[model samples]
Target: MTQQELQARYEAVMMNAFGAPKRVFERGEGIHLWDADGRRYLDLLSGLAVTGLGHAHPGVTAAITAQLGSLGHVSNFFASQPQVRLAERLAALTGHPDARVFFTNSGTEANEAAFKLTRLTGRTKVIAMEGAFHGRTMGALALTANPKYREPFEPLPGEVVFVPFGDEAALRAAADERTAAILIETVQGENGVVPVPDGFLAASRRIADEVGALLWIDEVQTGLGRCGEYLAHQADGVSADLITLAKGLGNGFPVGACIATGRAASLLQPGQHGTTFGGNPVAAAAGNAVLDALEGGVLENARATGAWLAWAIEALGHPRIEGVRGRGMLLGVVLTRDVAAQVADAALKAGYVINAPRPGVLRLAPPLIATPEDLAGFVEALPGLLDAHG
Candidate 1:
């Protein structure tokens, strides 16, 4: 069907939460996507950073095809090989060999599960940073603290207190025995890819330890090789009591996991928490395949290409460009004016795809498999796009 026809049908049937769809994409390969009209555009957004390995990855497709051909799902009543193995691998990634995992189908669900786990500590108070986007669920929204996202769903659950992002003094003053967990995203992607101040994570760990509160790192956007690390928090040199992951976990497949270690691991008993499609065999297979590709050499590519792309963009010396922030492939272009949205729209017409998370910040989260050469096109076109739009 045509893009216009599909959009009309979508607007009629869909909830309209995300507005009209951008375009009816016919297919995608590697770092490029083709709409139904046959126009090609570089996929810098990576489907909001979920398609880590890019579309139509051979291994991921083969794994999903193979898994579905044999055994799709047997439910949580019985154990499946892919589910068990993926759980083991995920637990190990948390740096806790015996860490426990509660699987979900999306990052929001993982955050919701983690939200419930915090109540097990007998504390409803959660310390979350301002400008942090946890999720839209009622439980996760309490920890999110965004007025636009939370005000509509007022009377949220939990005693979630908001603090200035990266303020050590505010965090230290807010913490006490009543606090359940200090939730933070090492890199606040929603706030224009802003990474916390240096030594912030370590300081949070110290404060949480002193107050006997759990340190929960929300790596949903920055994990799974997106930031050139197995887990973005690894670079902080502080281990979290709870870690939630998704987005790039299953590449494009829907899969999420909330991991807990030490005393936090045993909070959920047999009937405490569960999900039906969280770690189904097909999802597990996709996750395992992405993990394999990431571990093999895609991570290194992300690190190298990310560094080069960031440098290359800066080297352009465009007058509208202010600077760049964030780690690895997930970057935010700081613009001199609040025309990021216009630039992004212009970029879409120019055969590139990007988004403005904030008024003056354009977020670029390409697939992990993107090479420097693949990104050079976007980098070269950015100055003209910004000039025409900014």
Candidate 2:
């Protein structure tokens, strides 16, 4: 019943993969969460950018209820209306009407599917950006460049190269005819919410084309209106051969998709890949509800409120606060010192929930529905919080 009790039980049974639980969240609504102790906190992380529609969203709940009451899941052997409709919606959103969708249950699985799709290009090498975090699975892990995450799992899938995140020349040098795909994150979310350098994406596209490699953009954290756009790469006017999505796709519902466009759409053949519960009706319905909410002013609010939050943070001009980086709701508050962990802990005590993805970077991905008032409160509290920790 209490946070400590739940934490004890969790540690006794759970795998300890994520360390100790921060708090036992009992319930949430909009951008707020209540722990088991009945303490309330402003949730700025949005469950690591998954809850775009926020907790217990009425539209998302209603869609899930209706779909479950009607037809929940029918396996991949048979198609369901919601599943087919969601696929069409994703294809259209990709700016490639004829793009094919391969559904998965999580972002990692989506990246796994994309990894396999790359192999179908008759090439073996995959060039991924440095400081990239694709996923944890074996195939996706190979593409992830973090040494800490990859060292434990030795002899991972081979022929994977890592290049500087925003270096066009490095990418050009790494890519070649043998490169099956060039995987990149439009904005490196796990790498402190860093945005891709200007012109880097377009340059990557051109280089990939010259090398006959598929350009794969990982939009798991920046897609579905999280970064003020459907796909962050779209703002750069660069189209990818394969785009992997997940985090905000189902608004907290477990769902992901690998969208393949142009000739790459036909790469994966029948029996080559399969999923037991990838595009079930329930997840599809939830995905549709998230899209509905995004279309209905949530996206515009993200753009407006995000700009306001960035401006407010900059206006503080605190000595410890370096600057704010990122687009839309996905932001990272940079600090002059590597005390982000202390700041985040202090923020928790001050009734706020944020994350220090790096030693000096605090990542903020509040719900898309968060208002300017909510962000203003965080900005106002941030200075004192940093001072206390610093």
Candidate 3:
């Protein structure tokens, strides 16, 4: 079918919560997507940092097929190898030997589980960053900082106080003995792929320790190699009491996890929290495959290539290009003017995929598997996009 025909079908059946469709993508390979009209475009967004292993990855596909052959899913009442193995693998990544996990279907659900854990601390107040985006669910929404997403669903889950994103002084002032948890996103993706300031995570960990509150780091967008590390806090050499992960966990297969460490590990009792099909065999298998790729040097590529892309773009001498912020594949190209949306739209029309999360910030979160050549394509076309749109 033509693009217009597919778009018409989509509008007829789908809800308008996400606005209109850009293109009816038919298929993807590596870091490229093909639309209904068979136009090829470089996938720089990676489905909002989910498909880190790239489209139709053989490792993910093989694992999913093999798990389906053996056993697909069973109730949480009974344990499965894939599920247990995945939990163990991710827990080990925390570098905390006694880490525990609660699985969920998406980042929001993972945050929901973490929220309930906070309630178990016998405290109701939560300290969140000013530009953070946790998720859209009630509990997760409570921690999200944007009024636009929160005002519509007033009377959110808890008494959440928003502090400046990287201001340690404000964070210290907001947090106290009554604070149950301090929620920090390693990188504020929705607020324009902004990485937390240096030493910010360590300051948060210190403040949480002082207040006797859990340090909950939301790694939904920055974790698992997206930002050059398995967890962004690893760079700070500090461990979080609670860590929520999703997006790239299953490489496009819907799965998420809320991992707790130290005393926070045993906070959730048996009946306190549960999920029907959170980490079923199929999803776990997919997660395992993505992990294999991350461990097999895909992470290194993200680090090196991401740096090169930033330098290359700046090397263009484009006056509109102010600079770049963020680490690894998650970057926000800061434009001199508020033409981010225009540049992104022009790029898409020119057969590349990126997004404008804010007025002057263009977010680029390509797959971890994206090579220098692939990003070079986008950088080469960036000048033209800016020239036309800026």
> TM-scores, in order shown?
0.98, 0.99, 0.99
Best-to-worst order by lDDT is 2, 3, 1
Model 3 lDDT on a 0 to 1 scale? 0.92
* Models, CA RMSD each: 0.9, 0.8, 0.8
lDDT tens digits, residue span 11-63, model 2: 99999799999899999998899999999999999999999888999999999
lDDT of each: 0.91, 0.92, 0.92
After the best TM-score superposition of candidate 3, give how far the Cα of residue 229 lies from its true spot, in angstroms.
1.0
**Residue range with the least summed lDDT across 10 consecutive positions in model 2:** 371-380
lDDT of 3 by residue, 69-162 (tens): 9999898999898889999999999989999998899999999999999999999999999988999999899898889999999998788999
lDDT of 1 by residue, 1-390 (tens): 788988899899999799888788999998889998898989999998899899999999999999999999888888789998999999999888769988899999999999889989998889999999999988888888668988988888888899999899999999999999999998999889999889999999999999999999999999999999989998889999999999999888999999999999999988888899889999999989988888788889889888998899999999999999889989999999999989998998888889999999999999988998899989999999988975
C-alpha lDDT (0 to 100) for residue 22 of candidate 2: 86
Clash pairs detected, candidate 1 = none
